[model samples]
Target: MKTAEGLKDIIKPENLVYRKSSLITDKPFSYCPGCGHGTTHRIIAEVIEEENLAENTIGVCPVGCSVLMYDFLDLDIQQAAHGRAPAVATAIKRLMPEKFVFTYQGDGDLAAIGTSETIHACNRGENILIVFINNGIYGMTGGQMAPTTLEGMKSSTSPYGRDVKMMGNPLKMTELVAMLPGTCYVTRQSVHTPAAVRKAKKAIKKAVGYQKKGMGTCFIEIVSNCPSGWKMTPVESNKWMEENMFAYYKPGDLKVPAESDADAENKNEQ
Candidate 1:
């Protein structure tokens, strides 16, 4: 009888102490088993919940695999045209200044077709956040070549490998965005490991916090894995990201509100 009681105690819901998952793991995610989008989505959802910004948060999802993010995130979400998420987010934040507005974009949407929109939005110092996923290829568009495709990486369009002389090097979106003075916060993070995941969550939280504080543009470029496009298993894709991608796109905060004397002086003058 004592053993039976103990077993019942172990299985009790109160004894289990179940905390609501910041992530909605029960919902069927559209992403493949090894896709990094699922991890990114979970982190974003957790950050929103942890910060208690669900009511005032608004998300703009681009026309890519990330477009389905609206369905997964239990927040007010708007769908943007291909590569126009930044523009959409800018308008939303401008009209509803009190609300927190963010745009989720993929490499193909942000780096290629939306290049002009992304640059102008950052240049204008829009009070919004951008979560950019750099997965090398256009996963939603049948794995076509993206501007961020590394030199010599093969894609549907680049069957013989990307030729640097013709294709140019992969676009480093984070570095480019960080160069703009209007961009207050910019970082490159990954979801390949637990440590990296923690760092990414921190970066995401900081980005949203900056927006909430009425700071200008905040951009987070996440180097994500796409097993289906990369032709590697989930484990192999994680390994590949750590080895090759991390070196090229080293993860860290590339830009933030200036603390240096020169920056202070510039801000003072402005």
Candidate 2:
């Protein structure tokens, strides 16, 4: 076996192809082991680092599992009241137009109580990124049913599964936002696998780049898994999400800017 010093030269910077983002904190994540939140955080940090926005980026997080993100990312973070992240992010971006602003929200907060805030911000065409995580149930509050919970999905509150007749249908928030004219880009993605993570990271980078061009609202819904809330092992939760969550919240771009508009603008300039 090679000694520690003998291995140091082999692990030189020239040979390094991968490493954790410097924007990420040394503090361990409060999220549970195997949770997707950790991966999501890592990818976001990587995007900011790659874009060289570590000093200029601002993140807004509200209550629930999403709130702890401030501790994990070294960038400037502003905490908002539960379900009010979008509104807070709107103010930040408007006040500091030079800063890259984004909101990190969960389904329970964005699709339910903050529905108005989320809608208004997107409708007003806030030039900021909105990162929504949909775990179906309220992960931070004892697995209660959320507005995005699948029809017939069982939760602590919906012990027998959700009933569309009484409980109402699960809200496709991403699909709803895609129809809004103020939004320039919208998509649903997951981070359970390496390929999916790569796609998600790319989507995030694109959203950030759009802000520089003053594009309208950019939204990305991460169909994440909550093993603790779902009462399943991490592996089991991922499998279930693939079969059920993706069926309804299918992963793909829901909306993107029209090429004709860009073409017309270029023609006008010429």
TM-score of each: 0.89, 0.93
Q: What is the lDDT of candidate 1?
A: 0.87
lDDT, residue 53, model 2: 93
- Candidate 2 displacement at residue 79 in angstroms: 0.4
In the range 1-270, model 2's lDDT, one tens digit per residue, is 569888888898899989999998899999876788889999999999998999999999998897988889999999999889989999999899999999999999999989999998999999999999999989988899999999999999999999999999999999998989899989899999999999999889878867888989999999999999999999999999999999999999898778875465446536
> Per-residue lDDT for 110 in model 1?
96
Residue-level lDDT for 64 in candidate 1: 89
Model 2 residue runs over 4 Å out of place are 2-10, 260-270
Q: Which candidate tops TM-score?
A: 2
CA lDDT of 180 in candidate 2? 90
Which model scores highest in lDDT?
2
